[model samples]
Target: MIHHKTKVAVIGLGQWGRNHARIYAGMPNVHLAAVVDVNSADLRGFAHRYKAEAFTDYRKLLGQVDAVSVVVPTNLHFEVASAFLETESHVLVEKPMTATTAEAATLVELARRKNRVLLVGHVERFKPAVRRLAELARKPIFIQARRVRPYDRTRTMDVGVVMDLMIHDIDIVLSLVRGRIVEVGGLAVRVHNSQEDLAGCVAWLLASRVSADKAAEIEVTTPDRVIRLDYLKQRLAIHPFHGEVEDMAIHGDEPLLAELRHFINCVNGEEQPLVSGEDGLQALEVAHRLLQRMSTVAPPVRV
Candidate 1:
């Protein structure tokens, strides 16, 4: 029961990190305490806009903030998140929690030992349609998920498509499926010079570069019906074998905003994190497996 406003800060003022700062600044129960970025020029402007302190190095805000959002690159997740967890500050780290499973496990253990909330920023889990799909997907026999976007060099270069894009569906599929992943395989092609631009597998598919507009959808097959979800449109469709399609009426909200609110709720001890550190670790483990298989065909560059 927090009687006073929670002091919060967002590190890494990239595009998504900027969004975190925006949402935190608007929250009534939270104080946008600080913002951090390597680029001092952009950091100063954002800090002034949000009326929060700016830091070139994130370590300066270690003890000052009650909670922190680690929106840095995937490679920096372990370093940035572990520092705050050790300081007893709750953390909301973006997806692909760390570069390796070992690092992910270390953070999870640190959070447990410190008795602090460690929420992973698997923002798709907060989408209303995805939330509804989790409820309806009781006996999913087959699942297919696709997420693709145009090539962007500004973000996600530290990792390949499997970690950057496919991990979202991997996390979602793990939640939906009751059985363990007994067998896994993958194939990838490098469309971008930096990382594998396209990758495909049995259950989930991901691509970072698309010829046309962006796309995101998940289709699940049950014994009786097929359910399709459009992530960007926030729409759900249920198709029975013999009947007309049923469109589910989903209440829409910004997924990132909902995710941040959940993080704050976990910080206040009012709720548990929907995507825990352990969950993020599991997703990272599976992603590594897929990457291992893909490497046989085309070795990925280590960023």
Candidate 2:
């Protein structure tokens, strides 16, 4: 018997990109071919650690790898991922797909035209608790998610809280519920930074760069029961209308690792991506609608 390893590259060597590279390097059937970043300093340590070639320009790595993980900022997602797709390499783009629906649509079309596998990094969908919730909630009448984070001025300044944090919840809800969103209404506040830092839609999102605690939780209501998920604790609880609440057993697996393994399987033609480009676009569309709704509602006046 013979074995072949897929060549994988990680672009934009930031926090998430580095993690992607680390996982790919550790995988048995993947060759961590290269790591790309505009910052040579960012490329050096990770490339050396992973024993992969480093390139400052992503274009140089286009034809060199079988697949690439586009872990760049939201704005650069389209440019990087599309380039890889154009070169006929499979791509696993970080969540929110692209900055706009138009860009996302373009990437989806390009991937279809090229017959390349395009996977979106909706990591939460692979979480044990989320998967259990999807199985348990047969008909979700109402879904509420709260993703609050403490002040961290260093991350996600390119987009607001809704895009940064609520998007995960949005993707998960859309996956579980079969109905289209008939309407959306929400409020947002620029509590700390001039940027909008907090939002409340059907789900409440608090991506504050000024908060005191961190939390991630979701609750789903069906006709017969309510399911609660604690993302931080990785737990799921089911409350029936006429019985006591039951704590569901959830396997403690890292969502990102599961996501990457799924991507690898998809690239190998062993399975389809759990989260497709269309799914990412849908979630992005919902996030945009929520933002539009928030824009109409006036923020509270601060003294």
Candidate 3:
């Protein structure tokens, strides 16, 4: 059987986007067709190293690729991914999907209409620890997640930390709890940039309740025990009320590679996207709720 290689591109050569390019370049049965970024220097470097076409304008590769990873800024996600979808190309857009919930919904509908795969880049879903948590978190009564880090000046500052970081936790909690969010409230403060730099949100689910903290961890409590997952450490520990602490074994892999491979599989018609565009829209909805509340309540902080 002759297998045709899947032509793929990575739009946005920022820190995370470059990793996508590197991984796609090395994957089997995949051709890294192009890399796009406004920064000519970085684009040229990646193109030369990966031996793919380079484009400062993403529209140049519209009809040329089979699939693409939309790693651009939050504001540009809708435009870039929509264009690719219009060209019948599958898209794997990064987390938060788009700057607005409406934009997310549009992408979801567009992908459906075009019969193309629209996968969200919620990379955490690919983690082994997170996978185990999904299996063991049956009937979770309470959940808490913390994803905080020092401000990186180099990263895109177009959106607040809620949409940038907290959205991942929002996606996870929504996926595990699988309940309608009854209410949403949160407080955020802008310290370093125009956008909110720190945020904390609470979401009341029908069967489960969830909140956010100021660090990088997730704790899920059920009727019998509590499962603690450390995001950075990639560890899962379970503590029962009556028994000893039981550490859950996790087989870890580079999450980005796993996510990219899944996208490729979806493009190849071998599997469905684990994180679909609808899933991204759901997360973005919750994020907007929190942001809306915080905007009305939280006061600006002096840096």
The TM-score, computed over Cα atoms with residue i paired to residue i, of candidate 2 is 0.94
Poorest lDDT segment (10 consecutive residues) of candidate 1: 203-212
Tens-place lDDT digits, model 3, residues 1-303: 538999999999888999999999898878998998897576687798999998889998989889999999888999999999999999999987998898999999999999999999999999989999999899989998777765566766777777777888899998998889988887666566567766776653211111233356789999999999987777889999889998866776799999998899999899998999989999999888887777533454579
TM-score of each candidate structure, all chains considered together:
0.94, 0.94, 0.92
lDDT of 1 by residue, 154-234 (tens): 654777788888999999998888568887788787765657768888666655564367998999999899999999888
Candidate 2: misplaced stretches above 4 Å?
40-42, 203-209, 296-303
Candidate 3: misplaced stretches above 4 Å?
A: 204-215, 295-303
**lDDT of every predicted structure (CA atoms):** 0.88, 0.85, 0.85
Q: For model 1, which pairs clash?
A: none
- Per-model clash counts, in order, read 0, 1, 0
RMSD of 1: 3.3
Once fitted onto the true fold, the runs of candidate 1 whose alpha carbons sit more than 4 angstroms away are 153-156, 295-303
Q: In TM-score terms, which candidate is top?
A: 2
Whichever of 1 and 3 has more TM-score, that candidate is 1
* Full-model lDDT, candidate 3: 0.85
